[model samples]
Target chain A: MRHQTALNPREGDVLPPFEKTLTPVDLMAYGAATWDWYACHYNDAAARDLGLSAPFVDGQMWGAWFARQLRAYCGPQAFVGGMKLRYHAMCFAGDHVECRAVITSVSPLADGTEIEVSQQIEKAGTRVASCISVVILPATGVAETDSEHSAGKATEEGIRT
Target chain B: MSDLLSDEIRALIGAERYYPAHEEIGGAAIRYFAIAVGDTDPIYVDDAAARRQGYSGRIAPPTFVVETGQYAGNTPSANGYIPHEWPWPKGFRTIRGGQDYVFKRPIVPSDRISVRYRLESVEAKSSRDGRGQLLAVSLAEYLDAAGAIVATNRELFFLQPLEAGQ
Candidate 1:
C-alpha cells in the first residue's frame, strides 16, 4: 500500500519529535521478539547486581525507535539507506526517551534527493545516543527502483566501504 | 594481544558466511515483533488494514528482519540461516557498541528471505573495564528469493577477556 502523502524534506528541516516512556512490559516484549534476552534489559535485580542502577533498554531497540520516527516523516516509499549510531548513556525502563531528527543536507540525484538526517535520543536533557540516517526521496515522476534513471542509488557498500 | 583474543579471532575478519536456505516471513513472526517493539501500526498485523494502504497483505516492520534472519550458529534453526559463531576471544564476553541498517524494501508476509554475513573488520583497543581488548565488526545482508538485496545490517561488538582461569 502507498501513503497518499510524500515527504519532501529540505535542508535544515526538522521533523516532529517523538517520545516514549519505555516500560518493563515494553522491554520484555522487545526481548521476546528480537531473541535478545540479555539480563541487562529485563532483570532489574540482575542489573543492580552488575552495578547498573536499573535494567536498560536494548541498544538495537533504540535504533528501531528512530526508524519508526523517520519512516513516519519520510512516508512509506522513501528508503532508509542506512543509520550510524553511538551509545553514550544507558536508557532504563521508565526513563523518558525523546527521539528527534533534522535534515543536514540535500543532494539531488538523477533518481531522487538523497538527504542526510541527524538523529538523537535524549533522556532528562542528557544525550543517550547519536545517530545519522541517509534517506533517499524518489524524484517526482520517477519509477521506484528503476536503477537506470534514479538518482543517488548508493548501494550498501557505498555507505560502509 | 591478550591470550583471550587470539590471532585466530582476528583471522576471522574478511570471512564470508551464508545461510543454507531461505526462510519465509511468516505472520506469527511479524505479530510477535510488532508487539515486542510496542509498534501499534495496523499494517503490521491486520491484513485488511494493510490492504487499505495498498499492500497485498500484512507487511513486516523494517526491523523484523533482524530476528527472522539472525544466524542460528551451531544451534541453527531447522529452517533458518546457518549459525555463524561470533569470533570473540576465548573467555571474553561481548557487548554491543552500535548498529546500522539499510533497507531496500519493506518485507511482507510469505516472502522468502535469505541471509549472509561478512566479517568486515577487527581492531584492538582498551576500555576502562579492560587493559587490552578487541572491537569486532560484521555486516549481515538479507536478500529476497529473487536475489534482490532487501536489507543490510552492520554491527559493532566490544570484546573483553576475563582474568586467567576463572
Candidate 2:
C-alpha cells in the first residue's frame, strides 16, 4: 500500500493546488456521463443563445473534481463528511481551472481526525467557485480498508470517523 | 413582465416533490462517469478490486450519484421529463450556482435509486454585473432500493433574465 498522507495538516496549511485545462471533449464526456445533456454544455448555438462565449463546463464537474482531490488527499480510508460549494463565476470549455485548498481547522476525535478545508477553483486567476470540505480521517493504526471497515468502527467506537 | 418570484413559486418552499420512479444503477453508466471525471480508481471499475475493498461489488465514485438519473428517469409526466422544474422566470436562463453533498454509502451497479427534492429557499439577488435575478436553493435526497437514504445534495441555481444582457 502507498504511504498515506500524514494527517497532521496544520491550520492555515495550504495544499498543493491542482491545475487542469478543461476541453470540449471533457465537457462533452461529462455531459454524457451525468446525463445532464444541457444545451449550455454542448451546443455552441445553444450557448450563444444563452449569450455565453461558448459551451461551458458543468458546475457539478467542479464538485466532482473536488471530491476526487479530497479522496486522493485524504486517502481511501477517510470518510468525506460533507462538501459545500459556492459558484462565483463561469468556466468555459478550454479554460484552465485550478483548484486550491487550505486547511481551515483540524479537530481530533477518539479514533481519528476531522479536518475542514477551504477550497476554490480559479479560471485564469479569477475565482470561479469556492468550496468547503469536511472529512473524517481514520485512526492512525487503522488499515485503510474501503469505508466499510472504518465506518463500522466509527459507529461502534463513537468516533464518527 | 411577470415577476419570477411569484407567490406560487415562493409557496413551494418546504414543499417536497418526490420523483416517484426509481432507476437501476448500471455498470456502463458508472464506467462512463469514472472516465468523464478522469478518475482511475480501480474500485470504481474493477469488481475484484472493489470486492477486495469490502464492497459488495464494483462501487461508484462518491460523486456519481449526482448524475444518477438526473436527466433521464421517470417523472409524473408521461414523457419522463419534468419541464420548468427550475421555477425560474419565463425565458430567464438558469445556471448551476453551487452544490453541497453528503454521502452515507457507496452506490453500486444494479442498486435501485429514487430521488426526492424540495425547494429550500428562494432569494432575490443581483450579479456582479448588476443584473437582478433569483437564487434558488433546493435539496435532493437519494434513497436506495430498501428506502435507506444514501446521499443528499443542496444545489443552488442562478436564474438570469435575458434582458440583463449578461
Candidate 3:
C-alpha cells in the first residue's frame, strides 16, 4: 500500500483545474464502457434529427469526471460519500471543457473528516454542468472498513444534501 | 398541470420495478470503466495496491454502478432510457437533466448487485430556454446479494417540445 497523508481541506480553497477536449472516439468509448448506446450520443444523424448539430456528451459522464477529480484530489483513502449534479447546457464532441472544484465545507467526524466540494465543468467561459460532492477522508491510522465511518452512514445522516 | 402531462403519465409517479442481479463484478470491468473515464487511480485496477489501502480487493469506481446492468442476464434500459411501454406524450424529446448518487459502500469484485427503481415525482415547469417541459425524478436503490442497500441514484429527465426543424 502506498502511504498517503490525510488531506487537510479548508473551506473556500480552490483545487487545481483540469481540462479535456471531447472527441467522437472518446464519446464512443465512454458509451461502450458504460453500455449507453443512446443514438444521440453516437449518431450524428440521430442527433440532427433531434435538432442538434452533433452528438453530445452524456450528462452522467460528468458525474464520473467529478468523481475522478475528487479521487485525484483526496487520494486513495478518501471515499466519495455522495454527489449531486445539474446539467445546464449541452457539450458536443470536440469541445474543450475545463473542470474546477472548490472546497465548500469541512466537518470533523470521529474517524474521518467530511469535506463538501463544489465543482463545475465549463465549455469556453460558459458553464456546462455543476456538482456538489461529499468526500470522507479517514483520519490517520483509520481503516475504511470501520463500520461506523462507512459512506452509507454519511448519507443516512443527511449530510450529503 | 401542463397540457403535456397526461393522466396516465401522472399515474406513473411512485411506480417501482426491480431488475435482475448483475454478474459478479470483475477486475476487468472496473479497469475498463476507470480507463474510459480517464481515471488513473491504481486502486481500481491493482488488487495489491488496493490491499495495501486496506480494502479487501480492487474496488470499482464510485459511479460504476450505473453500468452494472450491462452484465445482467436481462439487459435493462440504459440510464434515462424511457421505455416505450410508458404512454409517453408525443411531440416531445426526452433529455437527461441531472443525477445524484449516494454510495453506501465500496463495491468490490465478486459482489453481485441489483437495482430497484421507483418514480418519485413528475412536475411541469417552464424551462430556461422558454419551453414548457415535464421534469421527472426517479430513484434507483442498488442492493447487494444479501439485500443490503449499497447505493442509491436519483435521476432527472426533461421532456420538452421539439423545436423548429426537429
Best by the TM-score measure:
3
User: Which pairs of residues collide in candidate 2?
Assistant: none
Give the winner by DockQ: 1 or 2.
2
What value does DockQ give for candidate 3? 0.33
lDDT to native, each model: 0.69, 0.73, 0.77
What TM-score number comes out for model 2? 0.83
Q: Which stretches of candidate 2 lie over 4 Å from their true place?
A: A140-161, B1-3, B70-84, B87-89, B129-131, B164-166
Model 1 TM-score?
0.78
Q: Report the backbone clash tally of model 1.
A: 7
Q: How far out, in Å, is residue B32 in model 2? A: 1.2
Kindly report the docking quality category of candidate 2: acceptable
Predicted structure with the largest lDDT when compared to the true one: 3
Which model scores highest in DockQ? Answer: 3
User: Number of clashes in model 3?
Assistant: 0
TM-score versus the correct structure, for each prediction:
0.78, 0.83, 0.87
Question: Tens digits of per-residue lDDT for model 1 on A55-153?
Answer: 777777777777666655664445677788777777888898778778999898898889898999899999988889888776653223211112233
* DockQ, all candidates in order: 0.21, 0.32, 0.33
Which wins on DockQ, candidate 2 or candidate 3?
3
